[model samples]
Target: MHVDVIPVGAGHITQDIARGLLTPVDHAERLKTYYGAAMQSPTDDREMIDVPQLGETGPAEDITSQLPRSVLTGVIQPRIEETLELVRDYLEAGGFDGIGARRVVLTGGGAQMPGIRELAQTILGKQVRIGRPCRVVGLADATAGPAFATCTGLLLYDQMAPLELSDERQTEAKEQPKGRLARMGRWFKENF
Candidate 1:
């Protein structure tokens, strides 16, 4: 079995812009529209963003220092740890034999964190790596980052594991003969 975890904000770089932290002219700009510099268009793709209001003079120094760390620990890290633990416990219960019999794939924006793969390895005690989607046009650079992993993987699955029904005939002894007597007999046999 192959398993992949996609981060919550997997495909959206737009949230970073609407919060006033990033300029529209940035790479994420393509994801947003501008009504002047201040009024930015909302993005459906990005994870919801909440920014504390800043006065004209701007935020305090200490507040800025704590912001990134707070987001990492409170939001991003917990989600990763939770997902990894659940997967580990599930695989163990299913009798999956260690790293060789298992593959844990992590994808999504959260997986792009600098030390996350190492952190996941320490916790999961299994090999964990990023997922890359395949078989789509205009996706050469999509897998370069974790944000597009799920969408990419979906495309890849479409290419590799195209759905098909089994061609072999199935012999169900009970279902093979269909008639009123057969049904009545089967019912009588089961019931009696």
Candidate 2:
């Protein structure tokens, strides 16, 4: 139930795009941001994208245009599928019992990709939707997406949270009999 961290976050998809496309991390990331999709579409074959291929050793200067949208899909889709599968396992262990989530809400920057919800639905067998932050008064539109949900939520909660008594107050109210022998003697006296 405590599957906290695995190789399944938005960054993994970026890394996959970089390694799989043999592009520099920067360019791969740019391509991913600009063009990456979770599934293949009709335009995938026709449209082209410039993938940075560092030729031989140091070809950062060369900067050649390469590959199509489908290549990005080929690399990105598998990684997405793999990450979700691991997530499925984690969910199953964490009391889901393989029934899967009725509705999967994807958050963060990764969820912004094209066709992501559909891809998640296909692999996870659930209705998928992109989640954004709401119900917070005066929250900035820029910081209102899934990427900032947890943080914004905490901040909002903190503002509205009620104060409670601390442990020190409760302990201060009780009598503190110090030594172990004294405590045992008091217990015996009370019981006897």
Best lDDT among the predictions, by candidate number: 2
lDDT of each: 0.50, 0.76
C-alpha displacement of 187 in model 2, angstroms?
A: 37
RMSD values for the candidates in order, in angstroms, are 12.8, 9.4
- Give the TM-score comparing model 2 with the true structure, all chains together: 0.73
What is the C-alpha lDDT profile of model 1 across 140-181, one tens digit per residue?
Answer: 764566678777667777777956635443435434568899
For model 2, residues 71-157, the per-residue Cα lDDT tens digits are 889898888888878766776677664554477677778888888888888877777788777767676778877787656766877
RMSD of 1: 12.8
TM-score of each: 0.47, 0.73
